[model samples]
Target chain A: MKMKQALLTLTATAGLLAALPAAAQFQKPEDAVKYRKAAFTVMATHFSRIGAMAQGRASFDGAAAAANAEIVADLAKLPFAGFVEGTSGTEKGSPKANVWSERAKFDAGAKKMQDEVAKLAVAAKANNLDQLKAAFGSAAQTCKACHDDFRNP
Target chain B: MKMKQALLTLTATAGLLAALPAAAQFQKPEDAVKYRKAAFTVMATHFSRIGAMAQGRASFDGAAAAANAEIVADLAKLPFAGFVEGTSGTEKGSPKANVWSERAKFDAGAKKMQDEVAKLAVAAKANNLDQLKAAFGSAAQTCKACHDDFRNP
Candidate 1:
């Protein structure tokens, strides 16, 4: 728990620099858009697998659930790396300008989501279905909340 | 190198069992398709970042390149977990039936690509541009070759 807290702090600190796109990393703003979208896609991929289990759409196999949750947690830190100012205002599934203008709230939302996903991973590791369900619900709420305010759709 | 050798042998061995879809891991074949596509998408995301630097389309920031390459190496092992017989037909980016019909060649291709990516990671960590280029080129070729034979593109 202490280690997760420390890592969360570090991720929050990294978020400070996140608003500024690393010029050397992307040749254009669209590349940043692509980067963030790709990260989100991966997040969706793993999350969907876990969600299916949670919803009873799929069997709850302990090992697969744990592995998927682990990936979701690790991937939680990646999309924010692409949330630069240049990426907003594009029509191609890019964020609206409010994401940057309301950066604090946006960042808080991101951090909360990350924390929730981390919890999901812990729950998955514990092999406690109840805990995993609660954590997954919390994580999903954070996702919906963030998207409601920050995303295009 | 010993560890890499061990992983490659293990991965190659696992390939022997790849044609059998793990019903425990995926309840539906589409889930497997989605999973592997997501893995490939993530791999492409990170690999392209390094590819840009290797091809001179982006700056060669040593630290970023190394970080990306390391992720690429890790992600290299993921997509195969999705390539099962259940996913070998139809579209939506699933493998062509030839992928299963020629499973041996496909697995060999997969192994070779993973090995080349591992080499790229080493080159990136060394911050040697020439080595990175060579390894990146080789890895890219492996990707194209595999797709040409196994994928519908």
Candidate 2:
């Protein structure tokens, strides 16, 4: 019993240690870009999976949807973090020079997107195909609005 | 004939006017983040849409796909301009203090993903579902790889 308790304690400590860097590490622009990109991609792929499930191209795929919902929930938190100012580093194909110039407006957009995505997570959790569809559409719209004004497209 | 020439002149002028801002705007971190978020969201959303089409839950939706492709192709260029050094500002959620520090790797990842998506666009033009599936999967994988190392999750 004592050995099992010790092992549990060790595992808990390791988990805690692992999380420390995640918070401190994501502070860099490159890291923020990486983190947000990762979360967005995961959400995107799972969203595709969910689309598949909804269309019945695949079955209910409850397991996949559940997994996807979990990812979406996490993604809701990422963009705000992506807004961590000073994180922007020189990349090969970044946006216009105006992004840094228009900081207030940009942050507002990010916050708006995060709010919508958060709502999407709730709808996704319900596992109602219709709800997911509606929520996802709304979230995608928020993404588009920001992209239209700020993104290169 | 004079009317036609005038129309031609106007169209050309409009095109130039449109192109000019893409070259001129968004110099700060705030502005860059806003713009980038838009581009990234468009890319992610379109990516999901293509996956939907490939799964056959939806129709070809050629117009939507083409528009999205155009947006993505254009947005791909935005990041390059947004990364000017010293432009990085003090945003709360964008990334961190380190993004500017590790700009090269971030740019590379973005490029890889963009290239993959461009491949998907070609497949989309062919309207070949199988090709779409293959390319989409490839593109998504790049997205996942970046996210795994960079994102919050």
Candidate 3:
């Protein structure tokens, strides 16, 4: 019985180890670009949902609100993990070549936006509708600023 | 006022009118989902930068912070414009079927998030770091609640 248990443990451990590299392997620039862009798109979509609620374009549901909020929080952290610098170049139909050219500036812009979003996340948990309205406005500006500089269209 | 100039202007207007629809043609679901995911990834990556600053993992610079904050603001709006209800299905590695199945709930969650981020943007403009921090925390929590239910790991 002990032997069987030990074998099971080993199998699980090996499986985990194997999976780690697959996840890690995507750290390449091309892959990072793909990952980052996907995450951003999701985050952007979620933001719209939130906007509908805040602006009275739509109503809110507590359970769904909770889920959307989580998406925002995770998005806040997604960018940091994939920060392989050259990944910027691998993106297609991206804003502009300037994203890579002014990498530091772009990074800095990204960071600021995340920080603000983080703040927005916290406010959201409280369900303070007024506060939420204000925070969303802040987050939206960050998107505009980056696109204006980095995005072509 | 001149006959030739008037004719030329009319011709240009006609040409532009004809070209407009093709230029503004909505993306198909496969393309929309793909493009949206790309945008989401960028937003997520950018969010990390702000997280770093907020946690004091890094320091803040006003100009950079402001710029990134702006990016978040614009990103908030992009997803909604491109939303084609059935498009999400065409994309790979997207959230679960429930995203469309329970779209009203999902939309509510999204709206709440937008409200919070917008508030964050306003706070950022005021240069109120304390308010920013508070708002950021709230926003983060809101995002988590949604992702727990809606997103795939």
Candidate 4:
């Protein structure tokens, strides 16, 4: 039994080691694109759900709204990590050179979006539709601001 | 400024009270339909991303795989909550009435899917590709199982 347990531990350790290089975030440019896009899509999905409620187009399920807000806040941190160097190839890069060139501005826009989404999460948890609307619009503007300058149209 | 802040607080409080009179859960069947569809779409998108890696079409990004698995696990909890009562209208409801009628069976299937997805998250995080594949297939089976029985064809 002790031998079997030891073997299991060894196997588990090997598997854990396999999972990391230690992922200096992504392994490739395509990875940067795909990861960022997936995270963005998830954000959009959750945002639209809350949008429907805030707009009064759908009946607001407070719990669902709050849950989605939390997820959106969490997702807000994901995209920028994908905005690393060497992801500037024009063919695979929808993000323009300004992301790397105007680094301070791009970072500020990302920060603004994250901050706005975080506030949106707070408003959502409080069930403050008005605050949610305000924060959501703010976040959307940040998205557009960065995209307009940095993203390929 | 103090008076303006107070007035703003007052208006916000009134809006919150108005938004909730109060919702026990969802007040719209259409909300349920849209929410579930959105959750399912997110799941499908993430699964396809991982599927591409697993099938060798895309390079395996360990971080991306782990991130996606976590999202899938979170999303697993979402669609089932949307499958609440009074979501029985066939037009707005993509879920068949059997979801409400065969509630026990449906709940079990949902649980099975959630459990499998949670396992997939664990496997992905561990970088155990073999186990990830196993859990991925299990989760896919659950999707097909539930859809075959309860979702619209």
Q: Which candidate is the best by lDDT?
A: 1
What fraction of the real A-B contacts shows up in model 3? 0.62
lDDT of each: 0.77, 0.57, 0.61, 0.71
Clash tally, candidates in order: 0, 52, 98, 0
**RMSD (CA, angstroms), candidate 3:** 21.1
Tell me the deviation in Å of residue A28 in model 1: 4.2
True contacts kept of each: 0.38, 0.00, 0.62, 0.00
DockQ, prediction 2: 0.02
User: Model 1: which docking level applies?
Assistant: acceptable
Clashing pairs in 4: none
With candidate 2 superimposed using the best TM-score fit, by how many Å does residue A145's alpha carbon deviate from the native? 20
Off by over 4 Å in 3: A1-153, B1-25, B81-83, B87-93
What is the C-alpha DockQ of each candidate? 0.30, 0.02, 0.23, 0.06
Q: lDDT at A1 for candidate 1?
A: 77
Candidate ranking (lDDT, best to worst): 1, 4, 3, 2
Q: What does candidate 4's lDDT look like per residue over A1-153, in tens digits?
A: 653564345334333433443235465666666666666765776787788887888786777788888778766666666676757655533888778888888877877777677767766766767777777788778878877888877
Identify the superior model by lDDT, candidate 1 or candidate 2.
Answer: 1
The most accurate candidate by DockQ is 1
The iRMS of model 2 comes to 13.9
Alpha carbon deviation, residue A130, candidate 4 (Å):
12
lDDT string, candidate 3, B1-153, tens digits: 353464344334333322322212243666565655565556554455566666776576555455555556445544543445655542435666687788788767766665555555555555656666776677677677667767766
Best by TM-score: 1
Determine which window of 10 residues in candidate 2 chain B has minimal summed lDDT. Answer: B14-23
Model 3, docking class:
acceptable
Q: Is 1 or 3 the stronger prediction by DockQ?
A: 1
